[model samples]
Target: MGQDAFMEPFSNLFCDLQCKIYFLLVGVCSALKLTVPPHTIHGIEGQPLHLTVNYNFNTTASEVQIIWLFERPQTNPKYLLGSVNQTVVPDLEYQHKFTLIPPNASLMINPLHISDEGNYIVKVNVRGNGTIAASQKIQVAVDVPVTKPIVHTEPSSGVVEYVGNMTLKCTVGKGTRVVYQWMKNGKRLHAGPNYTFSSNNATLLILPVVKEDIGNYSCLVSNPVSAMESEIIVPTIYYGPYGLRVKSDKGLKIGAVFTVDIGEAILFDCSADSNPPNTYSWIQRADNTTHVIKYGPHLEVLSDKVAQKTIDYMCRAFNNVTGKRDETHFTVIVTSVGLEKLAQKGKSLSSLAVITGISLLLILVMAFLFLWKRYQPYKVIQQKLQSRPETDYRKAQTFAGHESASDDFGIYEFVAIPDLAGGSRVSSQSVPGSDFISGQDMLSTVYEVIQHIPAQQQQDHQQ
Candidate 1:
């Protein structure tokens, strides 16, 4: 019975040892099932991104050891930092920039720079009964955040009507899964009848541009992480002159007359209301011909050139696009000294007036001379009849009787004939016995007497 008791104690001790071994094996199996494989960490190149290493253990342990390592493609692994229990120890090189807290199995990098990028390894050991080890490798990929996107238009300026299409492309330095949105006047725009968006949402197209399409436009670029906007761009649109009118620098003068004194220079301006400024040409009408003097909005004419009594000038303005033209006519009348000279001299007057006046004066003078000459012929006949005697009177009677049948004596008159012999000659005594008719028949008798009178007496009367 004493031997049996000693064997039972030893057997109990052996059972206790087997139970401990089974428990350790079970713990190992559970740890293998719960542990996670290594994974790569992702972060932006110039921004803070956390790197986490997850691990599992079968039993809760009071103290654990964690070590983090880093390696490049062709370089050896470098020890970064380690943690025991709740305390962390970091490599002197990166201690100030990188931080680690135990139990979390995570690492934080402040102001992550490009140099801290590569593959990382984490080794963990749980202290319970005997130490158990677990390890995982994580890859850290550092990338740069996308820079401010730029939107470029095919033709930076706006296009005219009936021109080709317009395109806007949004460009970013570095980004993934980007989206672009086009905005006009702070409103989002969608693809419509004339607008189309590209597949990647990076480009926007406007098929045709109309007058109403002018506005402030911008492009917005975004990703899951960040968004950026471009500066506003305004495009120029060209149009035409629709309504046109004239405006003079000096308001419209009465009758459109610009009066200036002699030797003075005057400026006349012509302006029209149009989309594009109109071209102007100054025209002057001289000697029945219209000529272009100058081309500009303003025209200056020296009064000395306008010596004439009245001068007329014109301004012609035209639109190249519409091919429409307008003209304004103005007259400058120089009434000071020019009109006076033209009137008094009468030198420049037409020929018709001069010819008519000379003709009337010549007719009046010729009538007076012819009337005076007609009486002379009658006086000579009267003198010849007064100087003859009775013997001649009978001869004259015979001639008178023959001519009296056709002569009208009532229209004839006579004055006494004067003696040419110093007023003392008795021509009356010589001719007293001859009966000279003293009536209308006297003129008939006188003409008859002159035809038959002797040549001696006729010569005495003519002397």
Candidate 2:
């Protein structure tokens, strides 16, 4: 009872001091103002942080003093540091952890750890004839940064399509206040009919697995200070044999039929979209009977090797896990039409070449005839002259009465011949001094001149 009675007065005195400080803080707002921007701040562990206090006073500050205090949950405020007239005095135990620059009551905490998270208080008092006081408060938080995350998948071996459930989890070694995001095939995953997320998205659940759910998955974790991403994880899911089809490299394919040249080799490819890839089988229909001829994704068919001219083929795909199957039907039609068409084309080309050659020959002949007819008369005359023997000419003189005037040079007389009953009268061609001369005389003169030249050439040869 005595101890309780003694503490009552001290409690009342504390209440009185608190009331005065509260009134003083309210009163100084008009004359002096205090401010702390960002009343709350978050910091990373092992990093530095700063808490600022801004103030302004209407009157001149003769002497200024600043005090800093630290408080936590359900605990009395403790003194950390103070400044007077541009000088700082900090607690010895925390001298290295806290800093104070006087006149501007901002605090700096270096190498901040988790223990530094708390509320901090600052008080400013100016002393002179008239004094005013102001104060500001700031809350600080420290956290450990997030690290690289890793993803883990349940039933890692595999899962059957439409009959199994899958779960994905994200794990990290070191972090505080971490968040998680799920991703598949580089796209953000969303909660849907087939998917559900845990509280923080650290875990993803797939109700029932399907082919659509099979993909590379990852996780991203983040916090205020740091972020991290997980490695990729691929979940195996067995599915069906879908979109089955047959393909060939060398053929004219239309509908399900392929037309290949006779004696040519054709390769057929069978495929489908399935997990644990589909087992392929080739079927041949011959003589109204079907038989499985081969087992593979590829088949080689030789047109001439098969007995039938037109044969039907089938490609079947089976999924061993899903127990589903699919098939495609196609016909391999063997024909010699490719070769026959080529032969006909060759014949047509040969005939066309022959006709072209004949037409060219005719054109050349016509051009030659046109040139010959244009100069026919000149050509005939030249040929006649060229065919004559130059040595056969007899040296004889003809009448040249036209060379001078008729009075100066006597003109030649042209005598007309008269017809008779028994014989024909002769006309005379002779050189005339004044009148015509006898033909017999002119003829003998020319003959004698011609005979004399040969006789002179023979005598020279004999000498």
> Quick one: best TM-score, which candidate?
2
Instruction: Output the TM-score of candidate 1.
Output: 0.38
User: For candidate 2, lDDT tens digit of each residue in 1-463?
Assistant: 2354335334545644654675576553356677897656889898899887788777667888787778788866667887888988777778888988777788899988888888887777776545566666789888899889988889887888899898898999899889899988999999999999999899999989888987889999998888888888888889989899998878777789888888989899999999999999999988789999999999999988988789999999999988999999999888987844355335445778889999999999999999986777455545644553433222111122232223333212233344565533545454434233344343333334333334443444335
Per candidate, the number of residue pairs that clash is 1, 0
Candidate 2: which stretches are off by over 4 Å? 1-29, 339-463
Candidate 2: pairs in clash? none
RMSD (CA, Å), candidate 2 to true, equals 15.0
Candidate 2, which ten residues in sequence have the lowest lDDT sum? 392-401
lDDT for each residue of candidate 1 in 1-463, tens digit (9 for 90 to 100): 2354335334434644554575577645245221333565556656787776577777667678777777789976677777898888777887887778878787788777667778776667676755556566677766555568887887875565446577888888877556788899999988898789988878888878654566788888776556788888765544433343233332224557754556656677777754246788988898999999899888776767765857888878786754667787888764455433344335566678778888998999999999987687577666865665644554443333333423422223334554575332212212323455543343565454445555654444335
Give the number of the best model, judged by lDDT.
2
Worst 10 residues of 1 by lDDT: 424-433
lDDT of each: 0.64, 0.75
How close is every model to the real structure, measured as TM-score?
A: 0.38, 0.67
